[model samples]
Target: MRSDLCSLLGIEKPIFSAPMGGAAGPDLVASVCNAGAYGVIPLWGKPVDQVAAGIDQIRALTDRRFAVNLNLSFAYEDALEACIQAGVHGVSLFWGMEPSAIARAKAGGLVVMSSVGSVAEGQAAEAAGADIIIAQGWEAGGHVWGQVSTMALVPAMVDAVGVPVVAAGGIADGRGMAAAFMLGASGVWIGTRFLASREATIHPDYLTHVLGASEAQTEWYHDLYDVAWPNAPHRALSNSTARAWRDAGAAPPGQRPNEHEIIGTRPGGDPVVRYQSYTPLPGTTGDVEAMSLWAGQGVALVREVQGAAEIVDEIFDEAMTCLAGGPGKPGPN
Candidate 1:
């Protein structure tokens, strides 16, 4: 059954994949959308032409609806303009709230989805004209924005905002989606689970680690991987770099262990140093283990890699079953 959020965003399922940087490429995004769920592509901080091309690529892949996310933490005017010009169905603004940016996207006839970490931020985004609010909790993978857990934040955000609330962070399976619905969320915003999708551009080693990790394997950091995106809190799986930092008593940035060591190189020959906030995509070479391996607490639920469409279908079907029976009730055996 289509939720109000599904209708609002012109999709059949109230499931929106998190725009996990390079991993949320056109193929995966298209696959998710084609499965009747919404997908999001990350074009944050990308050049205007590249942003336009990404949207075009998605258009070529599927006629289904999707959104392009822009990190408000960086300079995004040009990229936002490209999204508006491309006539994309929606735009996700994260990291911080920008009313003018939201206004511009709305003015361009684009539905605006903004991610927030707190009740105050949710209210602010709504007041700024955000069409939907993605309440990102602390357990989310990648660059996280808030300190509250999903259980605590979703209901509060729902209570605080008039717009539809999408509960993000630590939600990977149908149970979490059902829980979100019980908490008054219009939908669920999932990221870490998608990392195991066959279409994700993740390194083999990174995928392996994610598959083997448990709910307790993830660690929340206050800017540990801060080479590029400093001062942002994030969640990542434990690795040698993390062990070193813990061994060193969680030293500060400038004094952290392996402060400036080159650990890997991007596909384009850009150097990736230790403690850098970079996901290990395919073609990246060097000490991949030392690079940032982002994963949410929900990684435990993601046992194997599947096609993006399969994942969308599985979660959506399971969620419909669980939601039908009510929370804590098992679906038909």
Candidate 2:
């Protein structure tokens, strides 16, 4: 099923793999694009040369459509320049909104997508010339924008914006994909569900924690702390770090535990920090318990690690069956 988005990007399916920073690799992105879906590489914190190298790697693997994700809150100009140099097919912006940035991307003949958390933001994005708007609800993992659920946010975005809407957050299976389409989204951008796949470069320990987690396992630390993502909810597996923060009354400003110290590795490879986002915890080896696990509520739906191509094919096949008024069976090889 092709929507305006699919045709614009020259893809057969509207499903787009999120540019999961740190975790998403060239092989993973290429695998998705080769399967007739759009894959995105996160360009956060990477230098221009490194970003170009990653783009070159993906280009070498597949000649299909793909994109680069630019977190506007970061150094976006560098990311945009690298994407342009690498000849990316499209670009997606997150964190903050930038109309001029979108315009520049469009002027370069690249499709542009932006993530929005509210109706006003969605309308503004459309008015600013964003080709597509992604309604990212609070249930989404990683850094979040606001506190709206996808069910309520998607329809509102569709109504507010003339551009096509893509529903994100809490969507994992074919049923959720159909529900998003029913809710007026032309496409779906998934993250946590795909993060559990084998192609993802996250630590195996982190993946295991995701598999064993429940919806209630995630909580918001912003309410009790003065973090950068304050008031913005983030879904992650509950761990000692979280419990300690909660028990310590969220810690005073200077008292707040240092993320890099607690989560980062020590000099000379000492095992001081316990977790470091994507990397596995030091000394734990294959043990999954002593790490930080980032995931969405959709973790409940991910039971196994499959190839990226297979995962995309399964989701699309099941979604097509559902749209055809047939039982949406699980994707099989």
Candidate 3:
């Protein structure tokens, strides 16, 4: 079962814990890597010092391979420097792609993984020196890259790129992992499924909402004119806030609740409510409703909040069983 991806990342399993940015903590990341799966810490919008500190913390916890995610749209330079200085195992860049940044990361002897939306984007990333290219389909949580689904995107990128292809979006279980591998993906990156885990630092209420949500409960808000996310599509739970916006004919940006206001509480013992101001929600403080509840359609499959190590072990075990035949069943002799 060893592919180029497993060899390159030095992981026994082809699963990689996605960099959930503010939600992914050192314990969670370290735990995943310790479980023989790779873990990534999202470094979007954080100060270089903070990023360095976080990386240091993970390093102190585990000697296993791990990655630091760079949101290219923000202050990527500082983030890149932090990764280099901290001696991170690898770097994953999402959103916009920068060839020079990729070169710099690779020059520092760090493995580089880039996320793209389309086959063309995957090719470009490979050309730009990406060691691994993740094809993120529209069904993915957080910010989706392209309008295509994982089924279509995975094979396309595999054909177009020379580097290892990692499939993302709506993949949670071993069944999905087997499908991705069948489609030519060297590995898979999981986000939403891990988000519901006990290691995830999200608010309990938020986790509850995801666990209780049905497949139909999730909606693509980026399709609405009022909720565009630059080049990415976002899949989220349709809540009162989203419905109100849709019902109000998608009010102008200034008129709506600011992200910070929606997820943040006011001073003086005010109840926690959605931000009504213009500022975005501060990074990863667990204001469930205020911040974007980025999740995948696969959320319906998540039933409980288990430890990260337990969850990783279960996913790998289930995937191996499924690949053989079905759970607890043997493959063809």
Candidate 4:
């Protein structure tokens, strides 16, 4: 399991906690880093000062290295500048891999990483000076990158790009980690599993939803939960809001019923309209069931809410045990 990625990032394990927007907090990020795995903070939709403040808070908690990811699907030039000024150890760009931003991230003495949907995109990012590539399969939670499966995507990206490749999408447990290693990935990126961690402030009900959900219940669509951000494809559990639209012929965002209706309020007490990009955070009181429950096909494997340290160690140990057994053994997917 000792790879160049670990040496480059100064982490003990090849696991990375995906910078899930609106789900990951400073505590979870620091906890992942402290647990001998790399932690990435999601800098999407945040202002410069707020981004710097988050970096400072995480730095206060752990001296180990971590990375910050920006969703280039949205606006983020200022967020990159703030991360550079804050001296973040790394920067990962997702959605549309803006070449200039990756170059700037590299120029600022930060390890530049990119999340790509295809082998060509991975090659482009490497050509643009990215230090690593995250191959996001469609089975991943939240906004997915492409339609490929992890088994196929990871190997292709690894072969296409000169830099190290990290496998994401539909990966939640040690079996998945071992499977990723067999696929020739340098590491794995996990999201839904960590959302169940104690440090993450996700709503209790949301965690319950993930714990109880089957792979069949998770569906993918574009503009289904469009409010703050529109026309973007994502994976989420189909709730009342999503079902209502589906029953009505899956109308476009503008034609949906109760469009812009205030359905809930977050922990901050701000009114969140229906289909807006608001997760059921702690202290949120409203229709938590109807909020977009982003999860992956691998979510059915997530069984308990453990600390980040425990989760990392358990997964890594299991992966090693599985590898020690023999080659071509199917990991716990």
Candidate achieving higher TM-score, 1 or 4: 1
Whole-model lDDT per candidate: 0.91, 0.77, 0.78, 0.87
lDDT for model 3 comes to 0.78
Superposition TM-score, candidate 4 onto the true structure: 0.96
lDDT of 4 by residue, 63-151 (tens): 99999989887888889989888888998899896888888899999999899989989988999999999999999988887889888
Ranking by TM-score: 1, 4, 2, 3
Candidate 4: where is the Cα deviation over 4 Å? 326-333
What is candidate 3's lDDT per residue for 1-333, written digit by digit as tens?
677788999999888889885568898899999999999988667788888888888989899999999888767887897788777889999988788889999988889999999988887778878899989988887767678999999998898888999999988888888888889999999998998777787766677788888877777765322232343456777776777677777765556544324345433334444522111223334355543566788888888888888888888887777787775334575
lDDT of 1 by residue, 231-315 (tens): 9989999999999899999988899987889988999999999999898999999999888999999999999999988988888
What are the TM-scores, per candidate, against the unseen true structure?
0.97, 0.89, 0.88, 0.96
What pairs collide in candidate 1? Answer: none
Evaluate residue 58 in candidate 4 and report its C-alpha lDDT on the 0 to 100 scale: 94
Q: Where is model 4 poorest over a 10-residue stretch in terms of lDDT?
A: 324-333
- RMSD (Cα, Å) for all candidates, in order, is 1.6, 3.7, 4.1, 2.2
- The collision pairs in model 4 are 175-332
RMSD of model 2 against the true structure: 3.7
Regions of candidate 2 where Cα sits further than 4 Å from its true position: 223-233, 257-291, 329-333
How far residue 278's Cα lies from its native spot in candidate 1, in Å, is 0.4
Number of the top TM-score candidate: 1
Candidate with the greatest lDDT versus the true structure = 1
| lDDT of model 1 at position 2 | 75
